[model samples]
Target chain A: MELEELKNLWTELSDELEKQKNLTDKIIMNMTQQRYTNKFEKITRYESVGAVICFLVAIGILWKFEELDTWYLKLCGGITLAFLLIMPVLVLRAIHQIKKLNILELNYRDTIVAFEKARNHLLMIQQFGIYLSFVLFFTTIPVASKLLSNKDFFIMEKEFSLYVLIGVVMVFLYFFARWGYRSYKKITNSAENILNELDNGV
Target chain B: MTKEQKFTELIKDNEGVIFKITTVYTNNESDQKDLYQDIVYQLWKSFDSFRNESKISTWMYRVALNTAISHLRSRKKQPGGSGIDKIVQRATENEDQEFEDRLKILYAQIQKLNVLEKGLMLLLLEGKKYQEIAEITGLTESNVGTRISRIKQKLKSRILKS
Candidate 1:
């Protein structure tokens, strides 16, 4: 069929579809106003809940920081408390950037550009989250060791191999961080490729 | 009336556009219905932002195309085989075979095009001008012309071969 022929057929098809009128106006309107929350919106809500939990935990740790006997433990607690404070704001800001795309407000090209920027920002936040988690994991080691050292039973274990324990923890952290990075990259890359295809018209 | 009521009225008027678009982009009836709901949902989601800057039909075209494209992309990420064949077999067991055959052929040809090609072709099929197609698709007028010409040739060859 030629282009004109295909166009004619399309018109006929449209006419057929019009005659079908498969759905009621009420159903369409209901769906339209349905407040369809997508995956990203749900994820942001979960992140907000997590942010609250992080804030509470940070406050709890800071409250108990004075109880620590060692200077290093106090320092670790101080750094972790600072991280907990800063991390949520970073997370929230990334969420804000993603939310700001508001596809309904922008033109096609601008929407694609805005979505790309938001996804990239989100990818950066994911990377930062992974690295910060690794840093926190390492920092907690000494704090944990010191807290355990305070226990009389822990003090009795003079021949305990703290180096071996740290080595095992480090290995575990490495694999855990790698897995997190891979998952984030997979999601962001999928989104990024879609944007690229849109922008480049591939 | 209120905004919701007005928007509902507008959608009802342009309901043909929704069905045409959804049918063009999706292969099966179930996917078509899914895409139709998604387009309506997106239109309503973005309706408040629909300033009188453009014709309502134009704005609707843009939003519908955008939503359909995004929906297709997300579906690509996690594809599941459709049960549309069984559904069609059951629903149209006694329907007009001629109309069904023609539509099946038309949709088969359309599904051969890539996502961008499909969008451009759908707009062309709707009798949109190059400038209007460009406006909705974010392509330059000249680019739209070039792509449409190329797509036309590609479709011609495929149709002839078939």
Candidate 2:
């Protein structure tokens, strides 16, 4: 089919669509009455729960400050506490960037450029998240052990079991980070391919 | 008329654009509805910025295209996220088998185009000129011309092969 034929087809569909005309005034009002938010609500809610959990965990660790005895345990606690305290800001900022997109601001602007910048912003957060997984793995083991069972792996009499546990945690963190990176790539590869297509002139 | 009434009227007039853009951007059934509502919400939010009737179509094109390309597709059918799934289905329901088949083939071809090329081809198929396509897409007129020609050739070859 030539472009003209395809266009005729498109116009035929358009004519049919015009005849249908079923977006009632009530539906439009329901959609645009400051109640119908965008498609990011689920993930934003997920991230919110993640953030709240982080904040509460940070609070719990801070309150149990005295339990983290010894120099190394204190160091782990501090690292965990700092990450838990700071992660929510990074997360919520990314969520806010997505949720609070003002279309008025994008009117007549270079849209592809804006989209690239937004994707870069989201990727940066996800990149940070992958790195934070490593931080979480190392700090979480020590802090969690102390908080949950007071089993100080550092001062425990046995060393071989600790090695096995470390190996298991290492594998876990590897899979977790891989999941994060893969998730980010899945979301971005579509846009990336589009930009590549534009640049490649194909 | 009130601004809300005017916006509603304008949107009703251009709902076809919204419906078509949603289908172009999404292949999933539910995602199309979600995107349709999202574009409507955005157009409503940005209505004040583009009240010039002379260029309203251009403005709508810009908003719709921008929202579609930049939309992050996710699962959004949860309760309270939106109550418009049925609205979208009913709004887009077509009973004619011939029209449905033609639309499927058209969408299949459109889905084959790359994202930028998809936008350019859509504007072209909608009969937008190079300069207005330039205005809506923020591409130079020459760039739009070159890309549209390239897209046409690409489509021609694809359709011929098929």
| Per-candidate chain B TM | 0.82, 0.82
Residue ranges of candidate 2 with Cα displaced over 4 Å:
A107-109, A157-172, A186-190, A193-202, B51-54, B75-95, B160-162
What TM value does model 1 have? 0.70
Residue B96, model 1, lDDT: 67
User: What tens digits encode model 1's per-residue C-alpha lDDT throughout B1-162?
Assistant: 998788888887778778777766665676677777878888888788888888887899888877665443233321222213321232344676665566566666676676667778888999989888888878788878887898888987986786
Which residue pairs show backbone clashes in model 2? none
Residue B12 of model 1, lDDT score: 78
Error of 1 at B43 (Å): 3.1
TM-score against native, each model: 0.70, 0.84
- How far does residue A42 in candidate 1 sit from its true spot (Å)? 0.9
lDDT of 2: 0.75
Task: Tell how far residue B96 is off in model 2, in angstroms.
Answer: 3.7
Model 2's CAPRI class is acceptable
What ranges in model 1 sit over 4 Å off? Answer: A1-16, A144-202, B1-6, B19-38, B45-53, B66-122, B147-162
